[model samples]
Target: MSLQEINFDGLVGPSHNYAGLSLGNIASASHKGDTSYPKAAALQGVAKMRGNLERLGVQGFLLPLPRPNHRLAERLAYDGTEAPALRAAPWSASSMWTANAATVSPAPDTKDGKCHLTPANLVTMLHRAQEWPDTKRMLEVVFGDRDHFAVHDIVPPTFGDEGAANHMRFCEGHGSAGVEVFVYGRPGGKFPARQHEQSSRLVARQHGLDPEKCVFIEQNPVAIDAGAFHNDVVSVANERVLFTHAEAFADQQGAYNAILAAFPDLEVVEVPSDAVSLEEAIRTYLFNAQLVTLPDGTMALIVPEECRESASVWAYCERMMAGNGPIKHVIPVDVRQSMANGGGPACLRLRVVCDPATVDPRFMLDEAKADLLEKTIAEHYPEQIDPDDLWTESLEKHVVAARQALLTALGIGELA
Candidate 1:
């Protein structure tokens, strides 16, 4: 079976705001208290998805989760019967970054002959910690096919599993036997190492993955200090290619050696420190860009608009595309709203490799469905969502109703 890698990007939610909820994320902190454009944010995400479909000829998309988590706020013992924080309920649109949605082990890599997914606990951040319950519910609905998809409960929060953000898959092909690299951070780093080594091991075991095919690598502490909050921020892999910075992991050579041992033909594209410093790479999110094999068998880099602005980053990309490398094309996209919150193109999606026929029908997308989604966003999503608006009683009602309308429009229905 040939597996097709589909990117399921999260649609930005209606309550999208910048409350500086994420602590380690530099952009999220710097832009805290700034007014956010929820309507434009959601539409921008939709537009990016459409661009991917047109340019890459691939279609797989996810719906925005319902927001203003009053239930979760109440569970956390917040006095929701009154105003302010009660009404705010954190207003997290962080769900827009679906990269942390789950850790997926494709059928080819699993023992049960079924794709397995374990939703992230998101325990490192308070706002994100509340997301799993709803996230699990959403995944269960989207990947409900028991024969092909297994959506498992998140690991214990104490271990701190951050999902696919700390995981990467490398193989001869998606359907072939592959190596699963799980990168974890230690407690000594300036920033908290979000994904625990124990958590990654547990997830691999739960997925019934072969231990021989699993390799655990510790993230570089220097990278963490420099604000590479997640491994994906500095490194990303697809099929046989691993594109990363020179200092992406603690043992860079070890990671490369292990991967090379597993997939001998692995093409390691390392951006030397001389070409682009780690700071610039993280700042411009050069590594966070999505590296995809286009339908024509040529590869394309889906980069953030910031890359176009950075001279060094743009120059490196130009040189790579000009060479006979797997990355043959470069396409920049505008995701400023998501960028302001410390997420880039890769951060905004979860890559699932499988046969489309094995997944749920409603989750699949095409150009026609993309247009319909855009129409739905314009019709129902909010145009702007000021931080102050979250305190109003009416905003909650509108946000809830809007999500229902979106699900109804997409035929995915309401999730728990």
Candidate 2:
């Protein structure tokens, strides 16, 4: 069946205290290290994007891979005679900036269930410098289901002018439906980077799509520093595109007004600054909040709201609505550490697949599960547990504890 919606899986960067590579630093290294909070937040914002996809039967998993480490080898003489220099094996570690995890089966069928590495086709810091040969090797080793895999060649140590052109050719060779490219023009300008513009146009031409279909939206150039276009901007359900502009960036009114002028027919909603802070706006806009469509065709946007001096909170509401009524608050998930290094919940989870048959609008989690999970987690653990802290380690422990309690409560197992 054809997909009604496509949600990009996200990865959280390492935490500041975690003693690993920082995602913000990795993404901004090429630009002389002017870290964009919005970009960093967008990378971290993946944590906040869970419920909408979960409700749709779309499962998100963290990508599990180490960061690549590169060091040059010193030339050594063999048997006291100077000869040809020997090469040292490449060095690398699992990526901390890129959170990675996968589904697996306990059985030994070897094909029943296994983890697969889906390549991020976009450009990334590692690929930009061409420093991740080990990453590519590791991916080839684990992914058994190669047919289902596709690469996102937009980021990093791998992307360049030639890489972009090659990506276009690869997509065309495979006859992909089309490519999704986000265009962020220079502030107060109509065009994006010349290289990006040229590459995108070439790809569109190859796909036989009208150059006009290559959706372009105006975004603050400074915001681009934060990896703004890494997530969804165009809706997978109705193709409704969402864009945001903040007064801190530039002529806020004029930039937004100009964008509105360009796409007069598209639905454009000015997000309330009061409801969401500048940092939150930057992250949410870049991460691309989960857009779920109701049976009646009305859409709901689930976004991560940065609560007053606290961790991140999720806000579920209709984007078209003026007032905040009908808004429901999901339990705040503390991602302070991840956010510090530039990522959130949504960035940590990758949506592998969605069940189309279960898209019923009425479907939702039982309210009782919330209370049960909370109580089970609290009573079993004697240590202090803050409701606001939602780090992965804490959450995983709580979830396991809650499941055991739930099983016991259901008379299905003994809670030991």
The lDDT of each candidate is 0.85, 0.32
On residues 324-397, what C-alpha lDDT tens digit does candidate 1 reach at each position? 87888888999999999899999899988878877777878787787787787788777777777775788777
Total clashing pairs for each candidate: 0, 50
lDDT of 1 at 281: 94
Give the TM-score (vs. native) of candidate 2. Answer: 0.46
Which candidate leads the pack in TM-score? 1
Measured with C-alpha atoms, the lDDT of residue 155 in candidate 1 is: 98
**What is the per-residue lDDT of model 2 for residues 1-416, given as tens digits with 9 covering 90 to 100?**
23333233332222112222323332222322222222233223333434444454343222222221123222222232322111111111123223222211111111322222323323323222232333344334323234433222223322222121111100111112322333333423321221233434443333334343334333344444444322222111122333343433234565334434534433434445565554555443323343344434455544434432323313313232445422222233444434433444434433323223322211112334334433543454223222222233563354345435434643433112
